[model samples]
Target: MSGERRRVMILAYFYPPLAGGGVHRVLSFTRHLPAHGWDCTVVCAGPDDSWIRDPSLLDRVPAGTEVLRVGGGSGLALLQRLRGARTSATRSSTTIGWLRRAVDWFAFPDSYAGWAARARAVAARRLARGDISVLLSSSPPDSSHLAARSLARRFGLPWVADFRDPWVGLHFRTPPTPWHRARHRAAERAVVAEAAVVLAASHTHERELQALRGRDGRPLARSVVWLPNGYEPANAAASADAESPPRSRDGGAPTASTESRFLLVFTGTLALMDSTFTALEALARFVRARPAARSQLQMVLAGPYESSYAQRVAALGLADLVRLTGSLAHDQARALQRKADVLLLWKPLGVGYRTMVPGKLYEYLDAGRPILALLPSDDEAARMVLDAGGTVVPPGDAAAVERALEAAFGSWLQGGRVPERRPAWLTGHARERLAAELAGTLETIVKGRR
Candidate 1:
């Protein structure tokens, strides 16, 4: 109503300073879309309320980018539901977490149930202005898409559903029960059917979304597109001052000259499903086989680790070999990646880990460090590393890991380095390119409306 630019509502559960997989995808697009003929209004939950957020990441956004933080509302009202749940000595914290995990797996649409009410409220208010050209929702917290689906019907606005990861896919670890899986799939069908355009972060995701829509007996619209995740190259290249206490890594200068003795780095939350334990086991075995590797290797686990798991790690007697560096600022993690000799990637053996491509792989590529990919056999991360001209060791195979470590050490001693060929596919321009693709999809949607 006020300007020439088409107004778009970006409903993302994760936004800047919320340094997670969804953060970069949503943040970068909203940051750069002005040039592509769209003005964005990001609607997301408050960072303070999120499990993780990176306010600093917002520095890259255009000066006047409008961000609206809605409450984690009735969707998250389960805290009240579980508040009076039983507490017992038999129910240890680990058991409790698993219980929550079980509840999460079986709970259809409940994972993001907390944010639904507030997201709907915000979208309703924003779209009521009648100037919102498109309603875009990013999923997993698929609840946001549900909000957008509801808003689209209410406001008669064309909707764009952005799938950073597919809601129903090979990557999802759904409930074993058929009913639960069906409920989840039904929700996915509903959201996809209602969207004017459906976007996926990878070709794999796009294919899966197509299949899901096909399974639902919906129209085969040309609105689906693969918009792979990307890094902010200029921001990646920018240097951090030495005087500032390195915000993310081991609390030292990010551009430190001397190599950290035995320092292996991993960033991101150490989930129960992550292969951190297996990697630690491998590192322990590597040191046992090669004493020099032990003397030189300082394995650094970055990100938040579950306390119970940390105790398990201590029990493994890796207190000396493993340096538990707590969570760092997003930029700090990048700085640490810059200094790391071997960036570590770990994927769990079962369920969700195999099909998922960790977004951090792009960051690792941008870091230009040789990756020590400890992934499931034939997992996405392994493929990326191999494609990127890096090395990989199978997850949970301590013997194979030992062999890989020996070869890595021997190669390093012989000056073996990860090849300098930047995979033509990997680049920061993806966000801009993706925005253009989405714009075209929107154009198709706009045309169909006429």
Candidate 2:
């Protein structure tokens, strides 16, 4: 269908080895884009940092893709290294709190502020070779876009800016000073104005980005894209050495022992689980109302969790009911999801909250497990859950959270499996399908430049 593949450069700070929601979204593209007649050259942070690493993800990277790792920056990454080997508690440690405060005080664009200069220097050489036609930058550190913006200005190449989350409207903040707010807004507006095209991961985000205006009072960018996150079902099974699907010691489906209990599993970074403490109260209440149910119910958190979560679990007398598995490799995490009777997703309502959807929501749907989501009913994340036949309860509604817990457990106790409902439209959320959408967008951008 094509003669030669088009080459494009991608800048993503949270790529493979650095496990999280954003990593998979970028990884999926790299793996599937080559088939779409595109060559992906990714620039990401080195694996030597103290951040959570999922080495298995490297194997999933297509052999044809080029991944260049660069190191620099005094961000939270540097701060984490100072804590020695307490990597398991990386999320719960004091580093996160310090990082948040630091953002308000000094790290202008973001904590990886210092990393931008070095990244630009590296990317500058790659672009000078004349093989790259277009550029794409994905963000959370926001510094990636800053670097891409600079490179675009200097090289005169069109750049595509991807927002996994908003810059000025980011969730969870203590309200910055008027000066900092203006600076953030100005930076965000500049990016929107300069990017050739902007891709937003949330529907609400696309609408917000499209509303931004330039200094001349015009629409910010040429176009704003709504490209939501998706899940990849093939990566785990592609490698012979990868984690096999959830199985007990006998190499069969989850053991009868696991089926005998109501196992609720959650896998991902637990930093933003705002209503979990209140939800813990519900769990305690569940156990108290039916003391016998305590032995029948258990929740396993299969990713990095803050020490605060452990403390809260202990205080609410749920230490026995809740188990934290620190961190699991990417394939292992998906396998864990397959074994769960119910998956947990929680997001508390806040300003800009509806605009932020965690990447794991798609993975939860792909896992075909009933998701118990504690979210605002109006949020897009809540809609995804309901569409996929999952249950959603309003955050901070203890009575509703308890009811969800009670009902899920009741179903499990009756030797029933909540239907693993896969809607006809869910196939659209596959990684390959999403990559096709991206290929279409990238093709349009590249052709327009010619």
lDDT to native, each model: 0.67, 0.78
Which runs of model 2 end up more than 4 angstroms from their true locations?
Answer: 83-86, 168-175, 215-217, 234-257
- Distance (Å) between predicted and true CA of 106, model 1? 7.7
Per-residue lDDT tens digits for candidate 2, residues 1-450, read 246788779998877777777788899889998888889999888775545677777878898888888875347667666664344424644657776787667777777777777778888988888888789999877888989999999998889999988883334454468777777777887888889899999999999888877668888778998988877763435343234433331234532244567888888877757677767888888889999988787777777777788888888888777876665677777777876899998864577677888888887887789999888888888998898888988888788988998888887777677766666776787889888888888888877888
lDDT of 1: 0.67
Best by TM-score: 2
lDDT (10s digit) by residue, model 1, range 169-283 = 2245645667777777777777777677788776666776676536457754446776777676526444454123333223444322226363577877665545677777777
Candidate 1: regions farther than 4 A off: 1-4, 73-96, 105-107, 168-171, 213-222, 234-262, 351-354, 416-421
Alpha carbon deviation, residue 72, candidate 1 (Å): 3.4
Model 1, residue 12: distance off in Å is 1.2
